[model samples]
Target: MRVLLVAYGSRGDVEPMVGFAVQLRALGAEVQMCAPPDFAELLEGVGIPLAPIGQPVRPVVKGVVTGTAPMPAEGLPQRAAALVATTYDAVAAVAEGFDAVVATGLLPAAAGARSVAEKLGILYSFVAYFPTYLPSPHHPPFERPGRPFPPEVTDNRALWELDFETMNVLFGTGLNTHRASIGLPPVDDFRGYVLTGRPWLATDPALSPWPEPADIDVVQTGAWFRPDERPLPADLVAFLEGGPVPVYVGFGSIPVRDSADVARAAIEAVRAHGRRVIVSGGWADLDLIDDQGDCLAVGEVNHHVLFRRVAAVVHHGGAGTTTTAARAGAPQVVVPQMADQPYWAGRVADLGIGAAHDGPTPTFESLVAALETALAPETAARAAALSGMVRTDGATAAAKLLFDAVLTAEPQQ
Candidate 1:
């Protein structure tokens, strides 16, 4: 079977798919991932074969905060022709000849998958990294602007319910109006557009429910790990072995408003509690002051590989990261910066596997307190128990779902 894995966004989004890809290959399935252009080498370097696509998705979420395009319209269909003109060629390039196409992130890839799969008569499935399948029905809204929602709307469900007028504004008279200049037919929603999975609903497994019927095959596969994880970094391995188990502090792809402040506070907390620190800066840099001698600031460490030896894991609550930490048997302290972070924060705290620093990440005192709980003996024991229980064959589960539910379904065409 040929599996076409389509993903966008940063390393956090693309890396987990690698786990699935590696597992699929072992099962005699040909798996190829098409990610942002910049990830091409990193994927190759890690020995995971990939098909490169479009520009890199830089800190676009940060772009929204930085006042770039009103919000996270960094690369989306907000301006009608914006998506059509840019994504048509991209969709046209990688859309053909796959048993199934799976994607994540915003509308372009999902829409593109639908369009291309329809034309090729293949299956399309979307895998959400977090639960944005629909707007939060039971919580305060993220007032962030330029969300996939159009300018004319207020309530999330209203924007989701695109009326005919909104459709006209969206699609206009032509399928690819701007493409006419380059000579191409206009396009509309592509094909088999299903947001097939919701991994985190406000961090509560129960809340992540989809309003859409189960007909679309939107099932959670839990978190997956690649069969081909790189051996742990020499430095990380030595550090873990050399010291008392440290609390791991790092945000994944998402950034905080103040990295320095976060680092300082984390270092202080570590000293106060008499513990070493392993900071995985991830995309952000965390070079501490000379005074922070014991707090090791760093970047680009894989959680699956790093969490096994760490005592307590503290981080921004990306589903993949949190899940890996849990599976590794490490208690966590979550300082959710935005979106699903808060949700996961609550779940971890409630589950007794970790603690949450609600909203804007609470004060340093809260973080210190949460870390104390995370580092406690009982918390460590619970996390260790959870590690043994997760059945994290995410890759296998997803592959099974695709083969049985999607690829085997009647062709979309």
Candidate 2:
């Protein structure tokens, strides 16, 4: 079986699909992952074939990357040209050979998925990074500025993140202008205009609050599979052992221009509470100081493995990273910058799993108190219970759901 996995985003986003592709390969499926072209090495390194994309991988690294202000509010054009060059070509090249198309969130490949499915009369499936097109979510809306817009209405906070205006030009005027070029209809909405995969394959249903799982085929895969790895880094090991149960601090790949300010606040709070600090220095740069005894800096370590040893985890609240701590039964301090981050931060607090930190205006005393509360007897017990519940068969459930869909669609050849 040949399968195409289409997805894009930071390491956290692309990494999951890579894992999924590997699993599909183990099942005797030839897996080609369509992600940013720059991601070629990592994807191929993991043994998943690359369907390279044209766009630069969102310069998540800093001054070396994005020319414009590196905000999450990006349009389709910023990446569309690259998608056409890389993802489109990759799909077009293999549209004849692939048996199934599996698309991950917000990628042009969803359109490719539909095109291929129609061409070959094969299966087209979609997996979500967060809730892209599902109905009302169980968790708080990531960008619910207006009472969670209905699916019928487009241009919600999420849709604005895409290039709707240009999309209108292409699907409306352009398609109408050249009807004979390809049989394409005017898109319904820029985002959902693409051929959709099956609905969300989230592992845990408790987190998804959408009633009836939308009309489209939907499966929930809560937490994804945690990859196996070696022991913790030597620095992390020594830091954890020497510290008085440090607070784990890191914002995966967020770039706060004032890294020192955030670090200083975290350090002050840690000292106030008399706890050591482990900063994960994600994509942000924080300079080192000599006086801090309880503070350690490490990067690119697996949160799933590391959060287990920490007293509490502080981060920018990416879904994958937060879940790692959430499932580890550790409390969280979420310092969200933008996008779905604030939503997850709020969810953590509401679920009694963590607290949200307003950047620059942190109430150091109160936050320290919350940190203590997170470690309290009853709070710890509740967090443990939530962790157990979240240990929903992430990868296994997702794989089973995908395989089941494939069998139902194709009857195994």
Using lDDT as the measure, the top candidate is 1
TM-scores of the candidates in the order shown: 0.79, 0.79
Q: How does model 1 score by TM-score?
A: 0.79
Residue pairs with backbone overlap in model 1: 19-226, 114-190, 114-191, 115-190, 115-191, 175-186, 175-187, 176-186, 202-343, 203-343
Q: What is the C-alpha RMSD of each candidate to the true structure, in Å?
A: 4.9, 5.0
Please, what are the lDDT tens digits per residue for candidate 2 over residues 1-413?
A: 77777776566667777667656766667777777676676776677777665565546445423234543434434444334334545666766777777776544445544554555667776666555345333322333222334466463434443334435433334322322234544444544435343455543444433355444455666656546575888878887887477888777756665677767776777777778788777676654444657778786676777888887887777777777777788888787765667666767777877677654234467567657666666666766778877754566666666677777774211
Superposed on all Cα atoms, model 2 deviates from the true structure by an RMSD in Å of 5.0
Error of 1 at 353 (Å): 1.5
